[model samples]
Target chain A: MERVVTINLNGNAWQLDEAAYDALRAYLGAAEAGLKDNPDRAEILSDLEQAIADKCSVVLGPRKSVVSAGEMQAILKEMGPVTDSEGFAEGAAPKPPVDVEKRLYRLRQGAWFAGVCSGIGAFFKIDPTIVRVIFVIAALITQGAALLVYLVMMFVVPSAETSEEWAAAHGLPFNAQEIIDTAKKRFGEVAENQNRMWKSAQKPPREPKVNAFVSPVQKPAAGYGARMFAGVVASVCALAEAVIGLGVIFVVWSLFTTGAVLGVEAPDAWPLWGVIIGVVVASAFVTWPLRAARRAAFGALGYDAAGSEAAFSFFAFIFTVGGVWYAFQYWPAARDVIEPIWLWFRAIIAPGGF
Target chain B: MNPDEKFAPLRKGLLEFAILKVISGPAVYAADILARLQGTDFATQEGTLYPLLSRLRRDELVDYEWQESQAGPPRKYYRLTEMGRAHLDDLQAYWRGLNQTLDNLGTFGGA
Candidate 1:
């Protein structure tokens, strides 16, 4: 007999075989590690859970109860990998482009405001100052159509906020330091011109104060700070979603259990079967949702949330039925406890209010 | 666009103007919005549509409500807010003015 462990996922209870549970846990841990620094980490994680639940529910039919290892793997594959691949790290060497994936991004450090022209320059592999000059000339000649287009572009295209994002935008592996170097490369000529002007004054050869304007080391905090801020916002939004989901589940649970409480007809001599029936009724209502939520939680996180919900539901049902059967078979002790509770409920619930 | 890539700005006000125009009518879900955008130049743009919708919502031009669905979990149904309608009106007028300007570009005078 396989060991089935009950787990609460997204506030819903689910049963998983011990092996499946271990694998799912590992996958989720990887997802956390991979998305640890992502700005939309919370949103992506929530969406993932929802996706998993949907897929699992679809996978679990009338007969299937436990999610097998194969099903769990398939679910993750469909949702997309959460773990970062080996050799994919910060500042890794840029992979040689066998096929070009062109993407545009505004340079954060050297931009004269919105970095749109600089992004355009990077895309065309031209000097950004030349691109800025062209835009100025275009604005002058094209009756501000250039300005309107620029504004439109600012709203339409998203800015690349991180080296990983920059890489993804260009369909390349993330090489954070390389992209930073490229951004600095664009400003090299302008900086050199400024240096020449400074040197022509024939003053002492001072420290290369270019470090004051454009330091390669200063890039980390700005990139990370923005990501942290976005992550916080995402976490807040996710907390709100969780609160709402929990609230709904709580209401559903209470409604079922309380309704079952009213099912006892005779308060004075409470039949053990009546209490058992109430338990069975409550359990059915509780079990399906728990099963569904489990499937989703797993499926969303890369494990399809199905199969196991069935196994758990079956066990919960069997236990309830067996419990009621035992209580009815030996009704004397149960009646003592159930009798007072029945009396209180019957007294509280008014005549016609169900 | 590359030779193999057919993704157009489809009708290219980047679909924001058209999106608000559609939402200005009935409130709809993501699937409904996709359906409305279907057969237009913006068809097959699942990637672009979500970000555009997100930006529209972030700008407070649109809002969403969670509506329970019989088949799956509740879905977020999107609708235009009062601000969205006003923005749409401004955009429409600006579009008209741009069109008139383009028409008069035959004259050899610069603005």
Candidate 2:
């Protein structure tokens, strides 16, 4: 006599012979293992089992009898492709995937120092004891500095919580996976949205080939013209200074030579133009040093040399030479003819000058 | 029919149907269903029932509603949708065809 065992499946009872039961049990166990890591495994398995049970009932009929191995195999075959068996129902609306957020916590229960190890272990689904042992070894190697780091972490790191406020404070998400997915989706959506918006907002693209060539030439030419204009302005200013210096020298020379020859006292008061020439000369001397310093500063700040120092030096030299030449032209006229009398008077007052 | 035989098909059919059917309606509370099916041979453990219910729901033939139970935590109720009913109709038709073929084969030599 063949022995039979009764089992209930999908809220239904079934009386299966030992062979059938063993076959099903093995099948289900294997299926379960295969689906262990599947997100929808639970749902898929449930549906498949129901379909199997239903098929079995129809095939076996409602009578107590020993089911032969042949019959069992036939039923399994008629069940029509277990491999392609619909795991999930067709047209089951796709649900947005859910994300589970996990937290790290320092457990008060099993802590040696700051409980950081215990908390991290809990968060990562690991053994707290192992974490603690690792920390102990780390502390020994670091010479107790690990203790200070742990204390700082304890004070700095906030406890993980599901609340939005807590997550925000800790720079985490209440639902970390959900938030990340949503953010990624949103970014994609925004890019698409922007494209759509721009499509509507913008005018259609126009052919620029006709105008492009002219634009390139115009731009460069405008820049070149601006530089030339600036150079001309600088040169004109230098020329004006040189002319003014020459004019002052002529006036001073005429006044000093005429005044000395007539025995009239050369004007004790220097003309304002002389003072102007002196100032211009002093400015010329200072400008080169100042500009070199500026160029060095700019080079240090990573600007390429574009003859900025050369331009400054050239302007300074022009002004200096003009001033000195004008000064020399008037120097002989300004000399006193009664130098012997002046020297005797200077000697009595100060030996060095005499 | 013997009581065992008479009720056997009905029991089998109903249970199989219920598992798929419950998923169609609302979330079927596992515990409650267990209690309801208890005295009958249909009673099953939570582990077995839950996994099956999940499968039906996954297939989309049946959907589940998670209703808060006053007695305990939220319970999943299963319900049949239009799709599940259509599937059942197809299955019934297939069963009839199979039965006719079997009857014809059995009587083939005699006729």
Candidate 3:
């Protein structure tokens, strides 16, 4: 019978043979000694061990099963050696030292409570919303300690000024400064171009003798009727798209649930046409006013229409999803009647209501 | 320089070169440099390297740029000034001389 020793790590237990246990203990000792002078080494080693444990669980099964000495050696070997030569066996290579000068910066964009989410999101290549949600959960779980940490971070961590700043925060080379500087130079060029355009527009007309400007008169009322009509039309369209999108999601969800409960087979149909039309109408409703707002805010900054359109698309998707979810919760009564209509419409258009 | 003599100065030169090289590329800082060079038996403690680096900067042979390190804090990156380059050149010349002398001494001793 093989003797087993249990090692607890990150709340998970692993059973190891005596030889493997000795090896692991020896390895940990070496790692601790090697990293004694380096403050970050302990954390790095901990994370590395966790990573190995995670990989092991996937590779080797439960903690109760006897883990062979070879298996334990393999895991330690894969974790990379505590010493430099030992690292080579695990295919570890020495990383070039990081250049700190170029990467540090103050983050300016994506601030909700102090730009921590935005900075972290950028560093980890995750969406800011996900990071924000995780932060909120962490804060709640830690009984506000996480919030305190977040507040401290807000005060202590500077906003990232450039890509180099982001790179540095992630432990990348500071050489990214050259790239950021180039981008800034390009932005300056764009600004200069806009300035020249504005100057040309403001220049007095070439005609030598023009009558002194007749007193400019207020004509705000002249376009009031047209503006009012446009506003009404826009409001109506927005209302219609929002109502229809919500109605569809509500009907589909109700049908799905009822069918599942009643042991009825859900219809197999592709609702591609409805989705496409819904998306298009919904997008137009949200986009038109948003585009106008974007133009007003960014026009002077030389932003193009395409960029505004892209922003509109991204925001519209979020709005559409939110609107559908709200409809599912509040308009449950409409589902019974609307379900058949949705199905019929889907059938007529594409024969399948997905 | 004989083989044994060459190893000592060469080792010292390499250490100096490592410091200069790190500083010249981008300013990582002394602490970061020491941390990175940890596993290698190049130098034992960071305390010694820092003072020597500071002296080098003060001597005008090397200059420094203040930049932030990702690991924890702001770091000072050292760069080789014109004077430092001149010093490195002189050191290289001395290394060549020592190497040739060691080669000659080895042959003479064998004879």
Please identify model 1 stretches exceeding 4 Å from their true place.
A1-41, A44-354, B1-13, B44-48, B99-111
| Best DockQ among the predictions, by candidate number | 2
After superposition, candidate 2 runs with Cα above 4 Å error: A1-90, A93-113, A161-354, B1-91, B98-111
lDDT of each: 0.51, 0.47, 0.49
Tell me the tens digit of each residue's lDDT in model 1 across B65-90: 98999987787788988899899999
Candidate 3: segments with Cα more than 4 A from true spot: A1-161, A168-290, A296-303, A333-341, A350-354, B1-111
- Please, what are the lDDT tens digits per residue for candidate 3 over residues A1-354? 334566665445666665455445444544444444453443444444554455556556454475665676566655543433223224333333334443222233445644678777766656878989999999779755576566435433544432234455554432233333433444444335432211222222222211111111112111223333433343334344445555545444545445421344444463544544554576567656644654433222222454433433433454465444445456875455445656767998987556
Candidate 3 chain A minimal-lDDT segment of 10 residues: A209-218
Candidate 2 lDDT tens digits, A1-354: 334656656555666664455444434444454445556664655555555665565566556344544455455443322221132223122123233454444443345544567677766667878877877788789766565466445433433221222222223322234443443444443335432211222222222211110111111112223333433444444345445544444444445445432354444585645644554576567454544554443233222354333433444454555444444455654234234334656998998873
Lowest-sum lDDT 10-residue window in model 1 chain B: B3-12
Distance from true position, residue A13, model 1, in Å? Answer: 8.4
lDDT per residue for candidate 1 within A24-132, as digits (tens), equals: 4444444444555555444444445555566567777788766654565566555444422121222222133233356766554366755677677767778889988
